[model samples]
Target chain A: MLENKDLLGIKNLSPFEILSIIHTAEKMKLRINNKKLRENTLENYNMVTLFYENSTRTKMSFTMAGKYTGARVTDLGVATSSVNKGESLVDTGVTLDQMGFDIMVIRHSMTGTANLLARNVNASVINAGDGINEHPTQALLDLFTIYEKKKNFKDLKVAIIGDIAHSRVARSNIFGLKKLGAEVVVCGPATLIDKNIECLGAKVTTDLKEALKDADVVMGLRIQLERQKGGLFPDLREYSQIFGVNKDLMKYAKEDAILLHPGPVNRGVELSTDIIDGEQSLINEQVKNGVAVRMAIIDLLIERRKKDEVTNTKWSASESFIQDRWEKRYTG
Target chain B: MAAAKGGFTTICCMPNTNPVVDNEILVEYIKMKAEREAVVNVLPIGSITKGQKGEELSNIGLMAQAGICAISEDGKSVENAGLLKKAMKYASMFNLPVFSHCEDMSLVGGGVMNAGEMAQRIGMKGISADSEEVIVARDIILARSTGVKLHICHISTEGSVQLIREAKLRGEKVTAEVCPHHFSLTDEAVEGYDANTKMNPPLRAKKDVESIKKALKDNIIEIIATDHAPHHIDEKNCEYDKAAFGIVGLETALALGITHLVEEDIISPLELIEKMSTNPAKLLGIDKGSLEVGKVADITIVDPNEEYLIDANSFVSKSKNTPFNGHKVKGKVKYTIVAGKIVVDNGELMD
Candidate 1:
């Protein structure tokens, strides 16, 4: 395994690492799309996922992603385990790591819980979502899905429109997209969008027409009502009326552009149902590529897991360059 | 041709209420509810800890969550050092000002009364003001260490106000608050053994009250929070040793502020209004404490000169025990608009 490997959410990743993960995901996507890859490329490897919160898409994507990689994926379902029995989260991470997990994909409900978990685990850590903190791979796959279709991130004007206030996805994408040289416009009502994201070099705009004009991608974020402690919103209906991306707003974007949602979309509340299902929507491709990107993450982690295996294993010239970077990262 | 009515609205409500809003959801809910039913914007305080157990962290994505623009621990102090640091580190993330109740239960040992001469005279044990002071120190240190926004709630002592004022001068995001009772009453008010006067940090001495009053005039104490705790009669009617602490303050807050802080020549009328209506909103990082357009239509209209007597039985909230019962005071919320919708109009519930 690559020693000291960690994914504390994609926000902590730089542009090059994100590009590498995306390149790997792109290759995996081509294989999966062409129906030529059924090898379970990571058959003998082991991945342990420890989920400490409720998730629909992240859990399923990580699960299928590992299965597609040919790894022996053991799901450490936390609902009935010792984690629920007053066992601190640190002990749980140590338990999974000591049990020889090649990689650890974890989603926690507490902030910094994943970083805390990373310190305890021996395996590579991938944070799914730590409360509203950050979701690294989700951001990775999102960028991957976009870059795959667009072929580049430089100079792309993407508008992330929706609950920027409660979204870790928005935060990670702001970092990943900006690092890749994309100018992002974060849009929503004043209360729904975090204005400080402008510090990350994204322009903050409340005017939908202004934000969507000439945008290469209109990425809509979900309003996280489940995480609402009381109700930060005056009303979701009112929020939808003001900030939700509708067909009218979509008319302002680039003609060949796409609608991106880190799914579980709140139809008509954040984006119109028809637009989400429209041909311009890359929402499903995001989900499909979610597994592939996760597979890429797991494979990269496991490749670092193997010490001398890659020496005898032949890799392309570009991959050898990646290997050299990994060696420098480890030695440095 | 334009229709003209020369009048404004006011609201007298505490940002620290149940479901301790320390995140966007609670803030938006207040705004939504206020906009739909109330007449002005309803600014709420996000709880310092996610659910007020003071353990988990709340979402600091930003303070843009409608009604909740600020955070507070309500009646509890942050006990965990690491958690307090974490709370401070994420201070800039949500960009919220945090208010603390300023009592270290560990040091205070849950002493029901203030540690003072009155508690000794009544032969009932009291908590040392140091118990509250120590936590203030700890919180200040935490703020200095992590650069998080910090405000002391109910600065009932001279030491605490001095500390806050000094911290402010030193460029810390430090601010403070005093209650209507802290300057209006002393532990002597507890002489009748009234359980309603009993509170967590407890009431303090005359010198402390004077300090708070001076702090108010000096602008060291920026807001006059009501503490606005509501509890059923059964919870506060028993013996001092058995009854629960905390007296409901919602309806009485603005009146008490007008009576003690404004009418007594201690503070100016506009300054009192700013303290009650504006500075608290500022402390909590919201737009409610003002009259700015493109702003959430939250406006509170009040009769600052109106005279009224406090009655425990007729409060908007469902609690009756109050220390201010029978006290005469000026200032009343003529109307409370959450967002152009009137929740309370002419002392009537519009919803």
Candidate 2:
């Protein structure tokens, strides 16, 4: 059972919790394929998607996951919503909570937006993605996909390449992979990499070849071309040539090394066109697993909330019974 | 009442309030209000630019005559350099020190915390040290050229300290103040995503904290001021990037200094007093910060051995947006006398 009611980040999750989430996701993946086997795990549960930032894949993934589990999912369209009329994130969360929302999956442009909402509301908060912070579900799905290919996580060399500084995907993967006993190496240009990322228990390197050496899993992070305006790099062509994953770079890893990317992939930038469509690529599998992983996370959090409610009710009932006996005894 | 409860006999108010204090009328208005209603002395620092918009200079000469002790563009740097130079020249003519809030707006680029490992780890944009150091360098140069008494506010990074130290060595009329939060905390404090830890120039790295302590001890940084900005709970209880920058410092300032600097052997108690009280008074050209004969009895009596936790809820200030809540520290204020009248007694404000 998951100890936390909210899935904020992989950094806070234990090894047991990580394995449990992955195992539950495995069962969910089977249920996703077989319609007859689908259980109404989250029946009548009210889940809302509160995305402050624009997204198609992640938003749709969570929506579908909720629907499959028989939970009613509502997308709070931020652009058309009262957020423009100056309603704060807390206000929106509290209003939803008052309306009896069971879960809130939030993605915002600011770092720690989910944590902020989780602190204020009673609803179980799932961090879809926050600015520069962890995308816990994305990492979970990636882990699920990797586990499908590799039997166990132990001693698996995972080399993650490209914009590690701004990639929440890379940050979440590093945290999750390390807990599963995987040797994680983060490779990027000096400007695109953060200072002292080794503090997060990853081997930080600028050399792509060095990072990929004998790696079991090779992950590519999208190069946000908008960062070019900030002068992080000169241009995309230079970035593609140096840090971009290609057939040449793949030779550095093991023959059986599998590829992973949190998509909307920038072809020939973060990875070459060939590598993205190659047999070793698990990018398509990642999206499919995204729904299953989210379902598992939502179900687990709802289960935890139910357990808490039962415990609270039992305690309150016992206290009332004891008070009745004392009142009767004193009156008699 | 908040200033008095913080063991402050007098506090200089920043010009960044609603309706920026730019003119003689506003300066005089503040003086009148403080005299009528305030328990402690309130010295209003006038803005460097009219409306604090950084477009043109304010009524510096007129406001100085109207009893404004200093001129500042406190919340942000004056972006236009030539205009700032003119303001500095005008301020210098009136003998009012320019309290510069040094930050290059372009360099900040929507950063919420210090551009460091902690910010990167959490996926938040970082305000690089150069954002502050560049402006510190620019303002120091401007001060030297205009010969204005330049007082850098809330000096955080080590590079800024080094620049200020070198400026003082060159005998430029430059002095800097370090806030208690700067030396007491680091960017690591932002890990929990608490909006309270959010502040301007943000909490820097451990090396910067060490450098700030060293700067205080060596007299490279001459003063300690609370960039004591108070915001509504609604303003702070939001997303980290959306939250307002700054923590309430006036109440926690002395205790933090006593615990972090005095108890830790970074500086002696007398040196802490010199930094906190004497040096600030000297920079503002005030006649207080002493117990000498015939001096005004503006005294703050503190029991330096008393240990307690900082409870923001117990604060006399209406806003409890302080990051130092439950922070254990020594030193409790026993009495605060403004012109020999008891204002704060036993750490509580009196009528």
Best by lDDT: 2
lDDT tens digits, residue span A1-332, model 2: 78866788998999999889899998888889998988886788999999899899999999999988989999899999999999999889889989999999999888888877776677889999999889999999999989999988899999999888888899999899988988999999998887668878899899989999999999999888789988889999999998899998899999999999999999999999999999899999999999999989988988888997987633222323322322332333
What TM-score against the true fold does each predicted structure earn?
Answer: 0.50, 0.93
Candidate 1: lDDT of A209?
A: 87
Model 2 earns a TM-score of: 0.93
Looking at candidate 1 chain A, the ten consecutive residues that score lowest on lDDT are A314-323
Q: For model 2, how big is the iRMS in angstroms?
A: 10.7
The superposed Cα distance between candidate 2 and the true structure at residue B113, in angstroms, equals 1.5
Which candidate number has the best DockQ? Answer: 2
Superposed Cα deviation of residue A264, candidate 1 (Å) = 0.9
Clashing pairs in 2: A132-B123
Local distance difference test, each candidate: 0.72, 0.89
lDDT of 1 at B198: 83
**What does candidate 2's lDDT look like per residue over B252-275, in tens digits?**
899999999999999999999998
